[model samples]
Target: MLVHTAWNDLPGSVRRAVVARTGPVRSVTPAGAGATCRLAATLQTGSGVVFVKGILVGDRLAWTLRNEIRVNPHLPGIAPRLLWHVEQDGWLVAGFEHVAGRHADLRPGSADLSAVAAVLAGLAAAPRPGLPVRPFAARWSGLIDSWHVAGSTLAHTDMSRRNWLIGDGGARLVDWATPAVGPAWLDTAFTVVRLVRYGHSPADAEGWAGQIPAFSAASGESLTRFAGALADMWQRQQDRAPAAHRGLLVDAARAWCRYRSGRSAVLMSG
Candidate 1:
């Protein structure tokens, strides 16, 4: 099997350092990835399983790993267990008990939607210790603004089904670098759009959005406004992305626009 590492294109020293720290590094298997390269590896020393996230070695990456560790602890059962860090190879190696399941295509009747929503609710309800209570409100408000700015909520900005891992009883969310403390709706909206873009029915997207209270609490801003602004931002982001990713973004933006516009009309009619 092909083992994927972030610095696989780099020198042996880098790979070696990661191997030495983790274990024998039996094989580097690409695990969950989309915009970033992720690898799952088995250690020769019986180290079990380890995930290596490639990052340019620096304070920024350091801050990211630190944030992962800090947030993981507070998230409890909601997040993956952060095992260890390997700084030498410019890879952040974390060991999590491998979850057994595949990515949900996010269909209307799919079981994955509820699992994903549950995780989102848990994340929205989680405490940030020193992080302010209204930590998500400000960014959400900005997104609501016509200016169309990204929110600061510790949201799993990339709530793609790709990041959600399904196991026996529940699903766990991975990838923490993009955490934003914005409106809870922002996160849910992103997921809902992703599902809709992937061909899930409008009702499914609405169903998922309806299940979350954090969506309302964190985004005291008008839901329609936030949805419209996010769709616009998503479009701009799509423009800058490579053609491949742009397609996904385009689909997602359309779904977002459709839902937001429909919601607005409904409110006016009521």
Candidate 2:
């Protein structure tokens, strides 16, 4: 029962341009919505079904959308298929080939873990040309020193289980805008949190975290420092988000923190 947003009201020119390329849109289904002016809509077109991520116009909004479209294709099947993009109208609309799959949830299994792991693995590999890398390394390096010790090739900063879409074609990651140019552990840690929420054993989570340093080091960032940066990032997001959602994120972070702290105790005991 998602409601329409003012963003849903596309301008005549934008509508015509889309129809011209894609043909009349049969319907626009609300796929998902998130904070920060991001709305995912399923656009049914005569050619085929596509997903439109409408980002509000202005500010640095256009750059974020542009960054996503630029990097998503580099990841190929690992990410959604990009169709087209236009910055003219108030909203930046980028179309992707529809991917059919359920979001990752808290359920224990090898496949889910493996799928998530693969995504992180891919990120550790590296980013392609035409994408900026220093933004991540510089920020990560700064965080490491500021916090203490610390770090994706692919910047899937929002790699919660929910972001991974497992479909018949293959497992594809949605929400590409968050991609960055840093160590893979950053994304790995982010993804691990989601699995932990699904009730993954503390041992498993710790094991994953322990391995993060090596992965992140490939990008020249220390695990300890990167971790501090991540903590700060999470806090900033919680602070910036609306009050209602802030509590939710804070609770989630608190739970994960508790689990992580307990793991440290176990390691010390061992």
Candidate 3:
């Protein structure tokens, strides 16, 4: 588990570098360690509120911060703006336009579900930008075929509720620290798993995702294989870490895998 660095605990030079860009922080509320961020906080600055997230420059996963900076320009309304970045005293921090909003509700009958689907559809139709990012397959060890990273557009692999904020701008994604070059439809598929985790049945989750053109157009065989792969991966995660939250995902993944496997069997029989 990555420990969070308190805002006050940061070095004087590092804090100075951030304040220079944010314009004197009146109050700092620690945002906790996001995905791979070692330090995250929301600051009430003279100019406005800014969300800053960063990691130690010498940390093993510091590359994620670089990827966030590289991909920020490509995502417009779908993501918060990366106003600026600073590196000092072995720390790399990036300030983003703070978006005040609540985490999306993906439960059955939630209005946010449709909005989330719309966002995924728009992302799928977006033009692929040229960047030095690695393929999605590069992140996983032996899950290449399961990951299906051979598509043109980018993908936001992490689909947590907190990642999708519903605020003044409908929904805006945050923490693009580990985006990948893969099938845009894959992103929607990930959301389907989240929907199931949030109380939607496998069929309902699929139906909800089917509204998005990408998910609707995805190959059925690929979806089945992806479901099975996710179940196996999550099961392994549960065994290794035994985290309570991950255990919940393990159940969700297995449920989807069973549903998809049954669908595949029905299709073959017909």
Candidate 4:
């Protein structure tokens, strides 16, 4: 587990690094969420308040912070603006525009579903960033048909509810650390799995994801293949390291696969 750094306890060198860009810090409010970053807080600077997230310089996940900084500019309005970044002493910190909002409620029939769909649509429409990220389809290459693994869109592969913030402007996607290049509909499919974990039936989750034009336009066969690939992957992950959350994800993935298979059979019979 990552060790968290309290805002007031940050090293003086690190504080100076932040001060050089944002001016003197008036106050600091530590953020108590997210697993990847140990040092995250809202810094009240002389200019304004900004959300800053960081990790120890030697942490293996420090690369995630760099990745977030690299992708933020490419995301446009879909994510919070990356104001600045600092790598000093023994920490890597990046400041972002502070967005005040609540985590989206993705349960079936929640109004946040519409906002989530809109964000996914925006992600689908976004132009691919120039960075050379791995193609998402390659991750499941031989497990699924080759045709299912096509498209150049940037996908925010992780779509858990905690990553979404529902502000006055609808849903804003955060945590660009795990972005991938993949089919336009992939994120929506991932969202479907998460929706099932959040109490939606597999069918209901599929229906909710279908609200987005990109997902709606995808081939059912491709989606079924993708679902099976996800189920297999999650099952292996659970086997490798059993965790309560991973177990839930495994169940959700299988539920989605079964839903897709049943729907395919119904369509063929009809």
Candidate 5:
């Protein structure tokens, strides 16, 4: 379990690093939600408010904080701008331009769906960055067919509603800590599972995904393989270490696989 550190409790070296950039700190408010990070807060400075997230240097997931710093620059307007990053007193912290927006509501028929679609399309067009992160095929090697993993597109991978912000400009993706270079449609596929969690049936979630150009262009055979791969992956994760929400995700993934299986049957019959 992740333990949150109160802003006042941050080591002096870390606070000094933040103050160097933002000047005197007026207040600190916990901001955003995620299980991966030990600290996420908005610091009010004399200049302005900036969002900062960090983890202990010894934590295994500390590398993800560095990855977020490296990936945020490539995201452009699709994510909050990275102001700076600091490593001090056994902690790694990154500051970002604060975005005052609510978590996107992704239930069926919400206007946020279109914005989510637009964001996915934009991400599909982003240039691939030079990163050593594993490709989708290699990451899920045995779970998915090798043929479907041959694309250089950069994918955010994790598209939960908590990772999105519905701001004045539209939906913006956040927490790009687990980006991958893989099929352009992979992110869309991940979102389909999230849509299922948000009350959309598997069929409806797949329908929403199909509207995106990248996803629409992908072959049904590949999509079915991907769907089954995700189901298997989530089921294994749940079995090894049960999480309250992991079962829901596993159910959603299985539902998507069933939908694809039925579609494949129909196609074969025709």
Candidate 6:
């Protein structure tokens, strides 16, 4: 997890720059330890509420936030609008419209499933705006071709519970901190693991994934390879690091891989 910076920790000049865009800063609330930016917060401002994400100019991770800014402009209505951005006091910050919502519940039988599906469907249909977005890692090249990843427009490669929010309007995906160029079906694939993690059986989770046309069209061979490749990639990490274990997704991938091989019919929640 990233060591987050509180809103108050922002340099005075940086805060002033943000205020100029937001009117007056009344309260600042950090959005927890989000994956990329150094600062992520919701601020109560004189004009209204604005969510902000930022990074120090010299931080090695600044590229992540920069990609976020580039991609935000072309995002669909399901994403929060980027209101403004500022660079001051060696900090770079971007302000967004503060949307109100609760985290999506992806567990079995939850009403939020369709809502989450809608967001992914729309995201798949969205036109790829021109940007310097990178391709999916070369390590999974076989998964790439089988899934037709090269045919993708734009994808929010990271799909976690926290990245999805359910508001009165339905579901909206957030945290484009690390976007990628991959098959439209890839996000749906990422989501299958989430469904399995939450309680859905592999068959049931895949049944849910099948509702998305892209995933539905995926060949069984491709789906099998996708699962195996995803599992293997992180397993290698655990092998080398012996410590840095972000293995929940890996475990989910393994379970699905096993089921695809006709190995079992159970939801193995590790």
Candidate that would win on lDDT: 4
Q: Write the per-residue lDDT of candidate 5 for residues 38-81, one digit (tens) a residue.
A: 88999899889999998998987887888898888787889999
Off by over 4 Å in 5: 239-243
**Count of backbone clashes for each model?**
12, 14, 0, 0, 0, 0
Write down the RMSD of candidate 1 (Cα, Å): 4.6
Where model 1 places Cα greater than 4 Å from the true spot, the runs are 1-21, 30-34, 37-44, 58-70, 89-97, 129-143, 146-153, 216-221, 242-245
Q: Of models 2 and 3, which has the larger lDDT?
A: 3
Query: After aligning candidate 6 to the native by TM-score, how far in Å is the CA of 156 from where it should be?
Result: 0.5
For all candidates in order, the CA lDDT equals: 0.61, 0.62, 0.86, 0.88, 0.86, 0.79
TM-score per prediction, in order, is: 0.75, 0.76, 0.94, 0.93, 0.95, 0.88
Off by over 4 Å in 3: 144-149, 239-242
Arrange candidates, best lDDT first: 4, 5, 3, 6, 2, 1
Q: Could you tell which candidate, 2 or 4, scores higher by lDDT?
A: 4
Model 2 quality (TM-score): 0.76
lDDT per residue for candidate 3 within 1-270, as digits (tens), equals 468999889999999988888788899999788657889899999889998888998888999889889999999989999999999989999999899999999899998877788789999999887776667666664864734546777888989898899986698877787788777788998888988999999999999888899889888888887888888888877866648889888888899999999999999999
Residue 113, candidate 5: Cα error in Å is: 0.6
Models, CA RMSD each? 4.6, 4.3, 1.7, 1.8, 1.6, 4.5
TM-score of 6: 0.88
Displacement of residue 158 (Cα, Å) in model 3 is 0.8
Q: For residues 105-172, write the lDDT of model 4, one tens digit per residue.
A: 98877999889899899889777888887788776777887779678999989988889999998989
For model 2, the stretches where C-alpha displacement exceeds 4 angstroms are: 1-8, 126-130, 140-142, 146-152, 208-221, 242-270
Total backbone clashes of model 6? 0
Supply the global lDDT for candidate 3: 0.86
